[model samples]
Target chain A: MQTVIDAHNISKVYNPDTIPVHAVNSVHLHLNRGEFTALVGPSGSGKTTLLNIIGGLDAPTEGQVVINGINISELKPNQLINFRLHNIGFVFQAFNLIPVLTASENVEFIMLLQKRPKAERTRRVHELLASVGLSDKLNVRPSQLSGGQQQRVAVARALASRPQFILADEPTANLDSHSAATLLDIMEKMNREEAITFLFSTHDQRVIDRARRVITLVDGRIENDSAATQIRH
Target chain B: MLLKLAWRNIWRNRNRSLITMSAIASAVLLAVATVSLQQGVWEHLIKNLVSLYTGYAQVHAKGYWDEQTLENSFEIDKTVEQQVAGTPGVNAIAHRLESFALASSGDKTRGCLVVGINPAEEENLTRLSAKIQSGSMLESGQDGALVAEGLAEKLNLALGDTLVLLTQGYYGSTAAMKTPIRGLLHFGSPELNNQIAYIPIQLAQYWLDAPDRATSLVVGLEQAEDLPAVARSLKKSLPKTYEALTWKEMMPEINQHIEADSAGMYIMLGVLYMLISFGIFSTLLMMLAERQREFGMLNALGMQPWSIARVVLAETVFLTLCGSLAGLLLSYPLVWYLAENPIQLGGDMAEIYEKFGFEAIFPATVKAKIFVEQTLVVLSVGLVLAVYPVWRVLRLNAVEAMRN
Candidate 1:
């Protein structure tokens, strides 16, 4: 397994000079390729905050994040955006698919931004949407789809970029129990068969039970890691 | 793809987009109509002043404008007539001899300008026959006169009434004649109505005792815009002893009035544009606020700020185009109708305009450039208002926007 993400001494403080709140304080972690992991914590435990920093959506006040041996924290704003476009996939908590685009169009958007050829973009959009069991919803806009279907389209869009890893911030937060189980099954199958990496933040016990590895956070600090308890491959 | 997305996004909230588009269309319509009407009024003013007396241009003896005496008048020989008649844009030419005279009817007398004109040529240029309120138009070689309505009233004179005209003729000779008023002419111009009296060219020469002599040759063109080129051509073609003057040089007061009036109208139009810009800016601000979370999602999905800005700008461009084109199309029939049937001024407004020698009506122009220039102005206002959305997108904080 390859080491896909490495974080060292990450700290994020809000309003540091006056009545500061440490959102993610001095945390260090690593995620490997093909791993299905969950960052479990109560509310305000900084699980989402840490995930945001690792995904390059927010900057850490201290320390650095490395992805595929590159120091992502050192990149400039424009370069960081390009790097994220190529290397990081994000699944927001709200099923944030663009509402105006059809499922296939939403899935093809990132590839278009990458300037992929028309034939390749079409082929990849079909393949990704079909793999997510959304072949029938290809021409349906997000407004016309259910929450579970929209989330599936979002996952297809995330995979379109062929990023090194995916960071899902509570991907099942808006789904029912049945939908959540189906989504988790799809994600687990992708991890096992395609060897794609997924790191999610959730407080749901069902997600924790299905994860191959779990990291717990308390008060912006990593309390425990399953990797430390098991032998290295 | 981005543009297609933007196109769909605006239609997502159909009511909001339609309302904004209506506001833009209404603004464009009003602004265009206002500008067209103002320009039309100015053009009409110049046309009326020119055709009422001075035609498009005039060919005069070199020193006629400086000195009004009979010595400054010139002989209209065969060469001079042929030279002017062959000029390209010269639609018609009227020979005239103008001089100060005194008219009296039963002890009431007033000083007036006595103008001699070739009836057929003057009718072709100024449509003098149309201004005849009573009796018939003057004819060539007729010894009768056409007295203005106001001057007729001042002298207690009527059609067919004989009036005595007295003036000093060529070489200090006494010139006086009595002639019946063949027609009563009514003019919109106060100055002309109060003092002008027209008679046949032959009679004027016979009375002034200066035969075959005229002070100026008034040349009418096919269109008013051809005045400059035709004036230039005539100035070059005519003999050095004569000078050609366009309406602009002939009536500096009218030119000055048009310039001053247009400046004021432009200021009003500037204020109109500002109001329209603010209306568009308000709508754009609302659009930005409504799409905050969506913009944040896009940014979090690895989309650049400039890309988001481009999408927003594309949406604005689409809206402006739809609104502006519709407004322009709607304005066509309205402008055309108003141009053909001008709105009449009523009550004191008519009196005020008549007092200044202007017609009492508001007319619109159907010129192509008026529509084109107005569309560009409104589109520019839309573009200027787009800056708000672009700025908001460029500086958007993904986390904050998503949270909101």
Candidate 2:
């Protein structure tokens, strides 16, 4: 029942060439503390735009975004960076892992950004990689790992900071179906067990089926919000 | 952790790092070495000039220094020597007599400056004894005179040859003294080489009709910088009638010459710094551009804009310190090896240097100040040049950077 992310009539207009384009229009959503929500829309339907605003990566033209009792619109750049470092973790469609870092190093990176102690970061990295089934690939770079393994590392990284909210923008878009399903299972398990909120922007049925609550987006507006009671347990 | 990340990141593009370092090192090498050599040559030239002409400083009757004439002259005695030697920082003091005299040898006569000095004390102040190539310096007060080498050659004289000296001595007194040419000595400057002559202080006093009197006391010191301080102390310590002057104050023409030379060097150093600064700034600019995506992600990952600037500055500081020290170190042996065996300037340069009376060999001697000054200049300029990229990185938009 706890609202982790609350939006009020948020709209984003971008000026690409001195002419305004409505990227997202009059959108509203609320994510509970333990919710796994899916935002289903076609390409360019402003799914990423809404996700970016909620993640505090962007500012909308005419609305306020509130997360964890603080309105992000009120924060300056440095405060915003502090908020992101302490309270948010992100996993992107292409993995977005720094290619130069190894598997565990990529996961340990968030802990580093937090300026956590080295020994604690190492231990946490070990535990997270193990949890993601990548204990053996800890020292392997992204090029040396499979798609599913790299995505798992990203997932571990997203969970590294132990944030109340996680944002995944088409995380499984580049994975094989088997890898996709496997990753979805890991995300769902983390969502339910740890009470970590997750919001994914996906058109894939696999990702949609794995969500407890699904919101269908069309042309930058949410058309429907539905909940399914298909707990596979 | 910051240092660790910075170090590791530098090694990622080894070629780029090497190029940047090499640019810095070569810059330091050229600038520092050039400065060290120029300073060395300047010291050598001043040493020779001071030894040959006015000693390091002089003490004369008040108003006599500003206007050199017979009217302002004073007598020399044990009291003057005792007073000058009693002053602090006065290494040596010798009595001297100077007059404009006409010298005639078989009707070929020229106007010349005739100097009278105590042979023993003058030896401590100037290299007058060693400059005597043809005959002995006046060892005994009874006999012999030291004439200019060029003048002696023009007069067709050798050791023990006598020349007639005619002059209006002190108080409009007409006097003449038959003197034997004891030796011939060369001066550092061409004009002095042509027309100056030296004699025993008593003998010159006798010829000038002011027997036991001198025009001034030539004083010498251990170092050039000590000259002004000693001059000040002498001014306060000595009688009110006498004044003290350093070589720089006494010789305004030479001071102006050196000042003009150094001003030109300043303009040249500005050019060199611009070249090096551009080299460093260009390399850093390219590096920032190449690593745009990485910097964007670092910002996204919670590294603040200030932290990014610190990282870049750290890179430049490290590079500047290492390169400057390495260049200075390597240049030591290079310059020492070169100074010990100088490079000869052949053809036109050889002819030119010889014509100007400078040595044909270009030798470089290192000074501790040259190293410190050149290093400070390069580091400060490089840091200033670093401002461009640091500002660019701080103002860079994160999303646009990620797309870069």
Candidate 3:
């Protein structure tokens, strides 16, 4: 299987007066293409830190993270931004969409940044919004949307650019079980049907059960890597 | 889209936006009023002063005004009248004969300066003919004369009373003429206003035994704005024996008063700009600080630093444009109305202005430079202040911003 994300012995440290606090100590991670993976852990397990590092959002004290054969850590600051723009998408725990942009425009932001033709951006934005079942709410700002709807909009925005890999950090933590299950199903369908990789950092058992493969972490190290049972309809 | 977003964002916090906008509007209004009032008052003072003293601009016989004497008097034929009146910005030009003379009413004699003005064109230039308080102007080619109130009182001369005016004419000639004081004229100032008499140009010329001759041309301008330009142009085209001087050049004291007044106004305007700058800068800084998290969310959503900076600049530019334009629109009509009917100061205020030699009522006038300069200064201040907020946002770390 082609590797969508590969990190080797990644470590993150916070130094206070030259004394290091190891946030992620000697962490190694990998997510294959078309995989629906969960990084399950307790509080302070550094799962989110590892995900952030692999998503090209944060630099590690020591490591090499290659996403789709490109050495992300070796990229310059502006190149990393461009790399992230075309390759990796992130759905943060807070569903951080710009409050001023409409649900559709939020999804179209990356397209706008890429300077895509207006017609194509419009078409792709509408398609993504419809995929997330937000077609009727394109003009509504994020503040007016519900928590689940906002998260779905974030998912649509993450998938808007047709990125190969997507990372979700505690996406279902703030959602009700019904919305969480529906969101997991939507992500799973996109992952399997489109061969896109999905990575999540969470403690939600429902999210873990829905993910096809689970990577469990404890104390910044993977304790178990196993396949999840198929979700009962 | 960025502009639309910026516009929506500005109105998002209506109170803050309104506060900032109101501050800008009021500042602009105050600036307009200040400029118009100063310009209007100064122009009125100049015009009134010209009517009172030098008649806008004066044309003298070669060196007669530079060195006043009977010897310097030159012939005032139709040629001089045509030349003086043909000069650009010379709305009305007239000849005058100013000479030292003695006035006596039965042994009550006084030394006086007598000015002989052309009665035909003097009405437009000096308007002194209408100010004859006792009787009338020189009537219908009559050699009848007008005397200053103080000159009449000192000479004990009443209307229709006769007095002897004696002077040395051309070539050390002894000249004397007995003429009736047809009118008594009141003047504005205590200083030279009541020490002179006005007679018809021909009458004074004949009396001084220099027939068909006069001293200078008293010219009025069509527009004071063109005074300096007209003076320079006229100076270039002048006959070597003559000089063209605007009212400002003619009277050093009045020019000093205008410069001193403008200097004070400039200081006040500088202070006003500083005050407005502080108010606007603090408001923008506060808005920036309070919206750090909001901006962070925007950055996290992948808005480029340039995009963020652009949005802020657009908002500020829009705000200033709307505010300044509104201020200008409102001030135009206000100044127009004020110019038509000037404000009147009462009681002590009136007395103070009179003591200071300014009119009690202040007038307002529109000046084109006021609009252009006010815009440049205000926008420069705004553009300078915009740098702080943009730099602050650029220095922000996304993680720290989100954490905050």
List model 1 lDDT by residue over B154-260, tens digit each: 99999999978999996679899999999999886777888999999999999999999999899888887777778888888888999888888888888888889
lDDT of 2 by residue, B217-249 (tens): 888776666777788788788788888787788
**What's the DockQ for every one of the candidates?**
0.66, 0.42, 0.35
Answer with 1 or 3, whichever has the higher TM-score: 1
Docking class of 2: acceptable
Which 10 consecutive positions of candidate 3 chain A have the poorest summed lDDT?
A: A224-233
- Model 1 residue A164 CA deviation (Å) reads 2.3
- Cα deviation in Å at residue B157, candidate 1? 5.4
Q: lDDT, candidate 2, residue B402?
A: 72
Q: Of the candidates numbered 1 and 2, which has the greater lDDT value? A: 1
lDDT of 1 by residue, A1-233 (tens): 69999999999999999999998889999888999898988899999889989988899999899999999899988788888889988887789888889999999999998899999999999998888899899999998998988888889999999999989989998999988888888888888999999999997777787888889899999988885235122
lDDT head-to-head 2 vs 3, winner: 2
lDDT of 3 by residue, A1-233 (tens): 99888898898887835997777878777778999888887999888778878876678998889888898889976677677778877798888887778898888877887788899999998888887788999999999999999999999988877787888999999999888887888888888788889999988899888888888788877887888664223
- In model 2, the runs with Cα more than 4 Å from the true position are A16-18, A93-113, A125-160, A172-193, A202-209, A227-233, B76-90, B102-111, B130-137, B140-142, B181-192, B227-240, B343-361
Query: Which stretches of model 3 miss by more than 4 angstroms?
Result: A1-3, A6-9, A42-56, A64-79, A216-233, B51-93, B99-114, B119-198, B208-215, B218-220, B237-240, B368-372
The best candidate in terms of lDDT:
1
Model 1 misplaced regions, further than 4 Å = A227-233, B59-95, B104-110, B118-124, B127-164, B179-194, B200-206, B209-213, B217-250, B346-348
State candidate 2's DockQ. Answer: 0.42
lDDT of 1 at A96: 88
Cα misplacement distance, residue B278 of candidate 3 (Å)? 2.8
> Candidate 3 lDDT, tens digit per residue, B1-404?
78877787777778877777777777777888888988888777776667655777776667776678877777765765687678777788777887889988898888988878777778877787767897877754577788888788888889999978898986678889888889988764433444678778778877887787777777777876666766776677767767666677778888898799889988988898888788778877876877787676566545666788888888777767666777777777887888898988889988777676666778898887887678777778788889988898777565567667
